[model samples]
Target chain A: MPAVIPTDSVGLVHPQTVDFPEPLTLECGRSLPGYTLAYETYGTLNAARSNAILVCHALSGDHHAAGYHSVDDRKPGWWETMIGPGKPIDSNRFFIVCSNFIGSCRGSTGPASIDPATGEPWGLNFPMVTVRDWVRTQAALADRLGIAQWAAVVGGSLGGMQVLEWAMLYPERLRHAVVIAAAPRLTAQNIAFNEVCRQAIMTDPDFHEGRYYAHGTKPRRGLALARMIGHITYLSDDAMRAKFGRDTRNGKAFSFGFDVDFEVESYLRYQGSRFVEQFDANSYLYITKALDYFDPAAAYGGDLAAAFAPIRASVLVISFSTDWRFSPERSREIVQALYRAGREVAYAEIEAAHGHDSFLLPVPQYLAVMSAYLERIAQESGR
Target chain B: MPAVIPTDSVGLVHPQTVDFPEPLTLECGRSLPGYTLAYETYGTLNAARSNAILVCHALSGDHHAAGYHSVDDRKPGWWETMIGPGKPIDSNRFFIVCSNFIGSCRGSTGPASIDPATGEPWGLNFPMVTVRDWVRTQAALADRLGIAQWAAVVGGSLGGMQVLEWAMLYPERLRHAVVIAAAPRLTAQNIAFNEVCRQAIMTDPDFHEGRYYAHGTKPRRGLALARMIGHITYLSDDAMRAKFGRDTRNGKAFSFGFDVDFEVESYLRYQGSRFVEQFDANSYLYITKALDYFDPAAAYGGDLAAAFAPIRASVLVISFSTDWRFSPERSREIVQALYRAGREVAYAEIEAAHGHDSFLLPVPQYLAVMSAYLERIAQESGR
Candidate 1:
């Protein structure tokens, strides 16, 4: 196994943006003249440069996967629980890279980004991007960083789609792929939820056909409602029951009005309101469309196993028992397909109550399983 | 057993409004000086007035329970399938009375109703009404109609809550109570979904604090979004997959833009948009609050069995296997409580692909079971 780096070396990190001047083609047959990607890096690149791991984030997540963006940040990077020195993804031995996707709002070129021709935000003019486009863009970033092959590429949910894409589209570029709490392709129910969320944003008067930036207003309410809907799905019934359990917000009796009476309601409202401050409504639209459009099996003529037939990377698939968004049955589809394709793969159905969000939380068994798997990758690479 | 009436006797019906001149007290400690309830009757009440069956409508449902108000109407009543002649409820054998609940806007006194004192739409000024309050108002309507006792009180979903309330609060008034696809109380997850729907409408600028009637503009987009969210939850995953799969709207390939790409998206958008034309947003708020506040067990100090202990009505509880909104487990809570309370109860867990809406749909097995149960009620009541 690779030697663990000293814990003292891991600390706060800053994000950096890279400009790709070369034109890029999208899966939708559209071309972008140029784009910029915001990314963050942790730990160090080993002498052989063979110990690098690429981290992909889920929807609403950004490049700050680990460490605090500032000394006084109320919360550390989303994945801080698992990516510090000696942590699960262990920035100790392997250099880690996380980047906000092309159609995201966090310092990335998205609908909120300036258009070269109009000198206004791309808004509705931005071309639709797919999981394949994001993976290809990330590959380009890897090339710019002088890393020929990543030791592992890991992600959960939408991020997991990108990891699967990496294994399929650029098999030689990744040695290992970890997909957590994600489906091979979105189910009909998944698409339905995404559509409702998109409708929420687009129907907002302030959306102004996704040109809210020009109007000097944001679709805060629509974006917040979308987030509230999302937050509910991210949690399990058991988790919500344990957390709020029909408890009144301020007293033991019902307020008998439209006020946030229940603690769960208040919590959801807070989540929705807080999310709007950080997320772009148009980016939400674009990213969810990308998720709904993802169907590797379609590219392989509806044969999922065929999509994995040419992959050389060993795979790790993890699912939470309570993740109704992408249930364990969905994860089993990918594992079964990988097995049918004769790929080396590890599977774990972690016991968790946090639902789909369990992948980002610090569940002991989830962390330990991931940590053990990463150790195996380091040993196999002779890092 | 009472003789079945002629099938021709049950067909299209017109609604009648009943105005109460006296004040009605609500469970929320508020009072409405007077209110009107719009109702429709099918079949004839027996000479003794003991054969009357009160049918409560769910959220988004109104008094037009089993017929078209006019020949040119696009659709018959929402539950026309299960309540007409020779149907499961068998209006021929039971005089069925369906009423538009007080908070509803379908010719019923609600937020859209003019306040006599202010000479304006009540709007947000309308007092909150709970499930218990609705049942009480309904009981008063029964008295005004000269019905000494109702042979049965039937409802599903939110309506089912009213049925449960009838069994608990007006035990002597109803001899039989059928509660379908309901729970002892709203779970935290249930409340969360309701909160999101309410937020969608309340956040819309067009809502204008529920005074949209005065503004001459409606919160159509917000209401549509709320309905879209609701329509998703009403159908099971299997149902959506069977109905829509990954089929694109009018095309085999994705549109590469946000133009209702999926058939499910189109269906949901249609459901949302069409719902706004017939429903009132403030009524949505008030009714959901009643649903969220419905907790007979809470009122009885969290002892569900104790809450049902004093009920004299025989109970029939039905649940769909795929209803995640009020899952079988939630329905079982009511069944188990009734059992513990030593009430005469029958429980059926129907195999179904539709979710909560299974109660509203024409499922053969569900209708068969309900038919058999109602037959038993008829024989016992000498209807």
Candidate 2:
């Protein structure tokens, strides 16, 4: 077994890949023959190895959760504001592990990965994965690091879904679980948005039935459209109004042409264009499917409380006021279920203006509440 | 001048096309060399021509506001629910005129129409139009029909914008104005949604710079995607949840493939596919641009009250409870402005689950309110 490697860099983290020799059985009843998980670690594991904290990433997130991948990188990790030496998670006190999920394009075995059987990209051939599958894979990674139990598991959005799964499936493995801006299951409207995005990509001529890798072409236009749609949903109406208003680009009147006129339009276009460079279309399809298929209550005979009955970990669920995508009401559903199951759960519906993307933003109240919650967990675990 | 042709068949309307040989100048300072307006009229015009009411249609709506074009037609006119004999806008008591806007595809001079100069479709060459421009054209049509003034000008959504414009631009021409599910200006969020829809169509390779007609192909996929996005926004979250609550298609579990599994997805796909057959892509681009550019308050330096100051017509503004697209608050902006202008305005926020489309649906309360208001207008005008 490879020993856990500790990094000395203050605000930088490096990803390491670990290969699992055993074939992993997926929820769809398919097996992936030997897979590798790409992960990054911050700080050092204590002598007792109980100070480890696993961090889960959202749909477009990756292993770099807290630090700069390169010194000259234009932007830090997606959640840099909440991680690092003195941040809320406090890397100086607790060891942090963030991994790129199996179906992601960022240094993971996903649709972009080559299939040894056909000597081509997996694409649509990749097995469908569930939140439980991701949690189980994370558990295996934790075991390999010689951690008997993690002090806490924390995540937001899809990452938060993984946190909920970890609490339910491996109750004794973690002492605390934090789920933020997540839902028990996607609503019909949520699924509708995801389907439209899938349609956008699938209908693109360049997609080539997900075999675009073989043709050396990508569905950039379709992927950009999907990203633009997502960007609109991620922003609250108030936030958009405050940021862009009816402000025109370049302070000009309407050109009366098909040019980008409003600042919001230009911003969305940039978001769509920039996203295509970093994301894979097929990976997007797979992950969104995983999100849509996640219905914890379904496995428990439509009883959400029953699903949380076995959860032994102390749970913290956080939601934003303006997150219409996964509204605060959705968070209340999870919190109420935990309460109904006789579990210790803490929930905070933070007032925010950034909508679903608020979890990744640095809101002062949100940061303070997160810090307090982590402190309580640290005190309870005697870390 | 053509005589006012009244059809003897009840609940039936035949569209009449009138060509204007002279150039009609647009708000953007560009002129269409020659244009034709396609319109349909129901009921009989009184000897005084004072009972004539103009019914404006929203985006994707046509001149067929009541009755079927043919007996075998599968669907009645878009607003047939509210505009037939003995109905709310009662064709039995009022003369209703509905015309396809100049930028629409249904028998109107639009991007799909041929440009005599080029001997091809106008495509992107169609001049941009505003709500004010549409009202001016309608005024010209009324002149040609020997109807000096309208009894009431009624509309919903984008049509409502035109109704408001009529009250301000030609207050003496219309006695009553009914604005439903409309805003004084497009919000940043509204513009953002429109921008995404436009991007979806424009980015399509088949779009060919909006000249897809010349290329012997249409941007069906892109247009479909745009329509799907629009469909989502048009329906409220509660409406979607009630209609399709994660109900899978074909009574099967997850398909584990990209095929439509959720009923909502299937419905959106159907809407997208069906819209492509009846709608033109360049016309979509032009109309959405017009919608985004519509800001009645902008011309008055953001003083909505000032915009309504010259309005002599009595105003009725209606909003729906679950309409997130044009929220009740947006409707309130128009009503409050009318109040500040000391205009006779009646406001009603109907409890509806249909979102923006509630105005067109046969909601009992909506119908009752509309019927009573029109009765008051009729009594006042003594028609």
lDDT of 1 at A365: 99
Q: Model 2: how far is B348 from its true place, Å?
A: 0.3
Clash pairs for candidate 1: B2-B383
lDDT for model 2 comes to 0.89
**What does candidate 1's lDDT look like per residue over B203-315, in tens digits?**
88899999999899999988998898888888898889999989888866788999978899899989998999989999999999988888888867799999998899989
lDDT by residue for model 2 (B1-383), tens: 01321242244457899888799989999999988999999988888788889999898998988777765666778887788777778777888899888988999799999999999999888888878888989999999988889999999999999999999999899999999999988999999989888988988999999899989999999899999999999999889999998889977888888998899999999999999999999888888998999898887889999988999998999999999999999999999999999999999999999999899898899999999998887666565
Looking at candidate 2, what is the lDDT of residue B153?
97
lDDT for A127 (candidate 1): 97
Fraction of native Cα contacts reproduced by each candidate: 0.93, 0.89
How close is every model to the real structure, measured as TM-score?
0.96, 0.97
The lDDT values for all models are 0.89, 0.89
iRMS for all predictions? 0.8, 0.7
Off by over 4 Å in 2: A1-10, B1-10
TM-score of predicted chain B, candidate 1:
0.96
Model 1's CAPRI class is high
lDDT tens digits, residues A1-383, model 2?
A: 01321242236567899999799998889989878899999988878787889999999999988666665666777888888776789888888999888989998789999988999999999888878888888999998998778899999999999999999899999999999999999998899899889999999999999999989999999899889888888889999999999999988988888898899999999999999999999999999999999999987887999999999998999999999999999999999999999999999999999999999999999999999998876666556
